[model samples]
Target: MPDLFHPQMMGYLESLVPQRHEVMLEMEARAREIGFPIIGIAGGQFLYQIARMMKATRIFELGSGYGYSTAWFARAVRENGGGVVHHVVWDEKLSSQAKDYLGRLGYSDIVQFHVAEAVETLKATEERFDLIFNDIDKVGYPASIPVIKERLRPGGVLLVDNMFLHGSIFDPANTSEAVQAIRTTTKLLTQDPQFISSLIPIRDGIMLSYYVP
Candidate 1:
């Protein structure tokens, strides 16, 4: 991923936050060593703050890679009346690993891991969510907009990662499917009256949409 902030700025920003748990530190190291795309400290902290601000109870994650981002949401949910976080992922091995890490973090009981396609899982579920986090395949972004909007309760939040598509979104000639999907989905959220959206430039980028209806 490109550098979203200068090194000095990031150092200063990181200095302001409290230290993370030992399990989180391990996850961060593992992600770096394995070339995994776990949401880093900035993104995790942003999601944690947003979830807490919304007082999110029932949270759903479209894609959870080793439960790094899910951990942040799990903590917030635990502090806010103790609700559940349903994390959907495709790989069974990754799910198992995430379960173990979350268990170490004392969030195993609050997080339910589903090994399946995220959209399919969302379709099969009857429950609604107070907050929905999207980090699924970029191709699914366009298809996921309506589903996310539908699943989120009124005044709920729909937070998406990788809005910048690694900086390819700004190129008019970059007509790759992933970039196009992100563009279409972002347009859908930005133009829709039911949502108020903002794309914060941190890490790859974060698209936060608040459901008003």
Candidate 2:
């Protein structure tokens, strides 16, 4: 929650790109107006770049809200002729909103909506992903680690948002379930021999993990 970058730099970042769907733009405006972070444009842009660099053919997202980030990932995956994006949202209202928003963005075909818990939904789907993004319930992040690891295809990438939880992961006394989950997942990625992990200092901090084959 602290200012990782200066206001001038943030403004500079926002000025670099301007193309987005009308609905995506409106939803972003609403998030801004309501003082919600909801994946800043800079953050979305960065995520798109990551997906591109990884040459992601298929992607999965946990806790997609309003489809802003989903649209970015969709665009990145589209270059591969076409790809599937599964968005697991726990709230029906938010999931419906995201579905309608994505429909407006002309991405309903590439995106699928599942209004259910992420872990449970993952159990039923046999789909493997080239890239996975997790921004699910913070309290359940640790529990989802095994599930996420199980779902990631070999050599696939796992990108986790809100790793710092506003810098709470470092505090031993921080009692939030989400913070603890972040810490636990970070520890796994850090010590795992088959993966390379980095804590990216972009917007609330994102963790990028690459599986080694």
Candidate 3:
């Protein structure tokens, strides 16, 4: 997938990023080997920064592939003394792999990994979170807005990945469901009085929506 920044710009930004943990390095290698779509260093670092800034105690991740992004949040929560991250994935095998990865990162105790439909899992829980990270299937983005808004605590954060979807959202002619859903969701976020939203043009782009209640 094409990155949002130019090659040189991305390289320069990447150079400024601090070195990662050995486990993170290994995870990156694994993702590369599996051709997985991880948020990578830029996005992961940003997530950590946001979580730390908010002093986030409880977080919920809509779609956790192998716990890469979850690792970043988990680490942030640990540094803040204590917290829990609820991660949902549809595949049991993937959930198991995610557990192993979090275990390697020593975040297994801090993260709750669930293998189930993302929306259903959220609906079943009575938890309110300090942060909601949405990286689910793009076609379902719009559907998650009201649900997440309801569950997010006042002044909490909502971070949505793949907002650019390989730059598909910019092409007005593309009427694909994924593109339309994301566009509509973005519009809703921007138009909603409760959310202060902005598009972070980072890796694949991410939408940062802050809930004001």
Candidate 4:
């Protein structure tokens, strides 16, 4: 997926950027302390910069873990005078934790936290978005791509985190669902006519795809 830099190099690069929101800072700490590989601060910053650059208004996130990336998306849209971001966090405990953190940052008014399967939430919602983040069970990624692309406004972006899955996709001993999803999604994305895509390897690799129409 990503071949830009090694993980350590990316971490160094992450240190040079401004620190994340307090909530995400805490999440970063927790991710490190508990060995949560899903937390990607640099990857989040990359997405954040894209959102900021696009002046994203309405945003949506699938599988927002403790609101780390969601906070960045919220900040990007909020700085533009209070845009909304619907964050779908599947884990109840984690969702509660994220809500508390977002509330502390006064982003409570803009974030709609959903404690349900992200696909289900996406199916049920009627709102469109300017940006979308996909970070769910990797096996579910390919199936969700069409759903994600449909909801995005023209020129909107869909950012997929953990695109490499710790090199497991290429590891001979690994035969996991996540790996399969990564392969399938990557293949689908690279061949898609509507999207111009690229994979940036920072900590784990992130797939950035845009809708040109």
- lDDT per residue (tens digit) for residues 1-213 in model 3: 986457687567667779988888888899889899999788999999999999998999999998899999999999988889998999998899888888988998899988899977887789899999999999899998889988999999999999989988889899999999988998999999999999998788889999996
lDDT of 2 by residue, 1-213 (tens): 986567587568767867877787898898989786577787898888988888887898988886778988988888767878888887888888888888877788899899988778876778778888988877777777788778889899988889878878778888776777778888988788877999887778888899876
Q: What's the lDDT of the predicted structure labeled candidate 4?
A: 0.82
The number of clashing residue pairs in each candidate reads 0, 0, 0, 0
Q: Top TM-score: which candidate number? A: 3
Clashing pairs in 1: none
* Per-prediction TM-score: 0.95, 0.90, 0.95, 0.91
**Candidate 2, after superposition: displacement of residue 197 in Å?**
0.7
Summing lDDT over every window of 10 consecutive residues in candidate 4, give the lowest-scoring window. 2-11
**What lDDT tens digits, residue by residue, belong to model 1 across residues 41-87?**
87889899999998998999999988999999999999897989998
- TM-score, structure 2 vs. true: 0.90
Which candidate order results from sorting by TM-score in descending order? 3, 1, 4, 2
- In model 4, how large is the Cα lDDT of residue 137? 86
Q: Which ten residues in a row have the lowest lDDT in candidate 2?
A: 3-12
Which sections of candidate 4 miss by over 4 Å? Answer: 1-7
Candidate 1's C-alpha runs over 4 A off are: 1-7
RMSD in angstroms, all models?
2.5, 2.6, 2.6, 2.5
